[model samples]
Target: MSENVRAKAQETLALVDEVNAMVLSDPKAADAVTPLSQADANLGEEIRSRMDEIDMTDTQSIISFGSGAQTELQEISQAMLADVRNKDVGPAGDSLRSIVSTIRGFSVSELDVRRDRSWWEKLLGRAAPFAKFTAQYEKVQLQIDRVTEDLQKHEYTLLKDIKSLDLLYEKTLDFYDELALYIAAGTEKIKGLDEADIPAKEAEIAAAAEQDQVMKAQELRDLRAARDDLERRVHDLKLTRQVTMQSLPSIRLVQENDKSLVTKINSTLVNTVPLWETQLAQAVTIQRSAEAASAVREANDLTNELLTSNAKNLRDSNKVIRQEMERGVFDIEAVKQANADLIGTINESLQIADEGKAKRAKAEEELQKMEKDLRDTLASAKSRRDGVGDTSGTSVPKA
Candidate 1:
């Protein structure tokens, strides 16, 4: 073969290498992207249903919590406002104003809720919370609904882009292969013509009679240009495929509502809970201290009075002190129980969030495996084609 033919063959092989590299580097991404798209579709539905279910429950919880908080805030507000009117409880009400404002701010907007509860209602049945709890629960449900909708949008866009990248890579590979074949077949044909044993006179006449040499040469050069063009396409595809694959992995859905809701619940519990508990304790301690101080004062008066002449008033005062102590104990028990309920709700939210994270990870791993298998099959086929020479006269040489 002539040096030009050999050079073209090398160029053709280089193109095959470029194409193979583009296809092989991200086979898992190319092949697996299709199923990942479908998975994204399924995941959207699954997540929506789950969010709907969780939101229903969570909204009910939110409503319950919000109602209680609102009640406390309103009561505090009423007392302060009343004090402003009555001029008696004004200082006491003013003292509680900051707490009331904080509680009022904690209340979420009712309009933000998603109230579709057909299947969920049937599943949970009449076991649902009362009106107060339901109202509270619905508040949290709205936040979850917004998050799920955002997740669906994100997933749809990502899966579509990934599938497109996969198709682009496949086409790029095929183009490289076709162009390489064109070069290889052209080279073989030229080699045959060089080896042809024609008479010198016939060869000279044949060469002279062919006025189309320039056109033939032009066509060959065009083919070479085509091969080079395919190589560049394959190279760009490789880079695109890599970037696309990287983008795909992060497309897994994340619920900002899930994170924020859980965080808010925990943080609110952490900060407000201890303060409430301390206030209840302090109230009890102050009342007890006041009673003890009064008792000591009374005993001193009784001792001095007995030294002058009275046990009846002191006995009556002891009975009043016992009643107050019993009331304080009951209030403390109620506060503790409320704290426990809030903690339980926070824990449940965290568990659901963890399950969602795990599902995303599993889906990603399965997709990776699928793409890898496809690339391996393609590579093996190319290797076999390389081993076989073009003994079949139909095979054309590289242009």
Candidate 2:
């Protein structure tokens, strides 16, 4: 894999180098504006004037624009981490679960005897789930509206950034074009001074060496000094060109980064957001189906269990009824208990009668005894009364 990647990289680099060579081979790279005057016209002044004409400020601004876009891309990626999701389907789950639970409220009566809820209760039950669904619909619609608004907002931002990048890309190209021209002109100007102008001036000085040595010496000094100054100016322009050349890759890097950001933002607006919404909607549908399936499955299981339980209960009831029906009207144990209770009652009544007769005999004896004592007492009282009468008569006389 690494080898394959390296091979592909090399192939791409080769194509890039070929294109670079072609772009570098501009037919007008060399300076042709300055005519060769040999000793008259000011070629150095022309080169310096052209160098001043190049506006580096605009170039720097274009590069900064691309860089700023890259920074925005970084910030947007961070924002997207909180924004985009596949699971923000909202409050439908509670409603779906409630509906499922209501469905599962089927009792054993539903399977065996009659219905559990009345017709009115069942009709009213339908109203609750519908209202829950209506509430969920409102909530989900609000979320959809929010998602749509966010998508539109992001779409606007991405479009604006894309246009700015387009402008920046164009400006960068213009900068490279101007830089190439400046570099070419500066290089040719220096070459002309070195190869043609300075040599001619020196040759003129040599040709006048014997005729006016002093004046020629002064002229020579002036020529060399002017040449050095021009060289310095041309060198400064060359350095400027080199600086921009280094900046080429830096500008492209920033442009590429911004392009990456634009791609991502576009995808979020155009594709990912819509796809997430579609999937979220499908998720709600699937959840509803799952809830319904689960509810009915539980109810079905309960019905089966209810039937099994009823069968077992009926078997137990039948066994109890059969046992009772097969039994005799009077068990032997019950008859024996009744006979023993009757004999015990007779014994208790005979014992009560004998005790009553003995009490009556005792009462008669007591009565006879009372009679004899009373007679004797009466006789004694009569004698005492007669005696008391005599004593009272005698006491009245004695006291």
Candidate 3:
């Protein structure tokens, strides 16, 4: 080697030694960045940790680099909405039916509840009717308690989801750091190859050619090929680093979606839920205002009122049953939604198909464009070696 090349080789070795010393001497730096070889080993281990190591209950989550994170988040949003829906105490639409059911629970008919002197006195004077009503009110109060407890549980669950997002955010930060270390190491490795290894090989190849040392030149070419293979690995590492870059934003998007869901749940817990509870209380107050009339209505016309109510209920029930039975299994609105979803899925599929078709066409065009160049190169090679043999004692067999 020339003095300059020798000096350059020494400098490269010194630089590599300096890097090793830096990593080994500094504990913080050592922890932060693993060497390229060790990083590859770590990556192999990471890939090896598959389903058995993963949480079985993590089915609700999207894996780190997989698809459908947005879709999974959307489903989570829908589930959050569903969790808090129709959470009031009782069925608010059926007041008359509620009152009738309360009255029937006592099993005292119109005649029994009426006031002559003996039966009414034994049944607690005029308060006999209020007994079942008050009992029903107590039952409703218990129902409200149950509903409130359920709401609190859901709130707790949502808060847990928020904490889960925090955990995910922390994990993402770790991933970012890991990816940075990997990219830095890989870039350093590639830089070393480009600056030192390939240049040294090229210099040796040139000196060999000058001396007409064909075997040495051939051996140098093999060394260059080895470097090229390392370059390919570095290229793959860079692509992996790119994927890690993509993972950062994708993880953040997932975190942001989780935050949004938690925000909505918090809003329901902090604002909407209180308002709903107030509305429920006001509704109970209004229902209480109707209880006095409900308590006293059975003197003699109680039987007539009951009969009319029963007949009306029967008629309403029959009409509802007939209308529902005559109706198709699928509602028009449901059918419309299904049609919309189907169209959207088909359109998405077609879009993907078009993209694939375009890619295939482009690939074919490039292949055709290269075909002539490839043929020309082969023809040139054949002409150069037509009657000539390898002067290095390497034989080329007849094709």
Candidate 4:
């Protein structure tokens, strides 16, 4: 019985260590920003049901222990009476003396050999059968003390296991919450840039141009440039939205798997630990009987099976998380490609705008030069005609 309890304690501690490592290393909790899915909700409900079962099992086990303890006490009492009636008082007294001495070495103050010896002396002179019965009672009491100690230790270990699991669960939830908030805030920021900032800048530029305020050419250029930049930003924001939408499914899948994993851990903590306690308690109750060893073996086997099942579940969940993470990475790459395309488009448009502005300026300069040349030619022609006399002409003829 002691060996079984010790083994269970070690196993519980190992489980605690394993859980701590897993929680600390879990990347999904760190990265998953998506909301929980329907599958996640269903898994949570299933885990809750399993927890309810554990509670019911614990309750029933307590009732069973109470009834079983009572029955065992009566049976032990009957056996003591029979042994007293049939066996030699001297041999029973000697056996009890040895048990008391051993218990005393372990500081079992309740079963004081010295006090028992005095009581035995008195009963020996008066009644040998009663003395035999007293010895048997002392032996049973010692066994009860040992079993009680074992149960207390087991309970303590189980409580530790539950506490560790609860800590892990809280940490996992906190990480996910942080990730969700991060994603939400990013989405809101992009929306504001697209819907609010860009439109406001465009309006400001249009108003400035309409008033025709004698602003510096540089200032006008800056305003127009700011408007163009905002337009590009709006395009970028659209791409971001597209990428986020595309990634949502993968994110949701990862979140679902992560939630399932946490639920599994919770189920192990709530269900497995209590179940082990109950089974060990049952085994302890029968530890003085011929069936003690077999009871312990059965309990161990059941615990091993539960652990194996939990491990398999965790492995499957981990695989889903990895796959979803890979999908998320792919979605991110798609977003990068979209941004690259947007950049190329914006650059090409800017280049075309610059070329158009240059062409219009050159055309205006050429038109002004042609008008000046025509005016010069007309002025020269008039001067030459004025300078030439009305040659010969009319005046001489009139004379």
Best by TM-score: 2
lDDT of 4 by residue, 190-289 (tens): 3454578546655556677655534434454554454344334334433433443444445444434434443433343345444544543443344334
Ranking by TM-score: 2, 3, 1, 4
How does model 3 score by TM-score? Answer: 0.34
Cα error of candidate 4 at position 381, Å: 99
How does candidate 1 fare on TM-score?
Answer: 0.22
Q: Write candidate 2's Cα lDDT for 1-399 as tens digits.
A: 123433433343443333224222122222322333331345555435554443322433222221222344445435444443432433323333333343344221122111245588677874434334445544554554444444334433433444444444445444544444444444555566678866876777778758686776776576555545555544554454455445545645544554454444344434554554465456456556765777889999999999999999999999999999998999878999998998998988888888888888888898889998788766665666567576553432311
Model 2, 101: alpha-carbon shift in Å? 33
Better of 2 and 4 by TM-score: 2
Candidate 3: where are CA atoms >4 Å away?
1-154, 177-181, 202-222, 293-399
* Superposition TM-score, candidate 2 onto the true structure: 0.48
Off by over 4 Å in 2: 1-229, 265-290, 312-339, 379-399
Better of 1 and 3 by lDDT: 3
Candidate 2, residue 295: Cα displacement in angstroms equals 2.3
Error of 1 at 363 (Å): 99
Write down the lDDT of every candidate, Cα atoms only: 0.42, 0.50, 0.50, 0.46
Residue 99 in candidate 1, Cα distance off native in Å? 14
Q: Runs in model 4 with CA error above 4 Å? A: 1-177, 180-399
Structure candidate 2, residue pairs in collision:
none
lDDT of 1 by residue, 1-399 (tens): 224433433443443333224323322534222221233565444323322321211324222211221244345436545643653222222323433443354333322223344587768763322332344434433433333333333333333333333444344444333323222232222233335512332344447546865655554454444434433443443454455455433321122222333233333333443454355345445544655776798999988989654466767787899878778645767888988988988898899889988998998888888888778766665665666563543343333
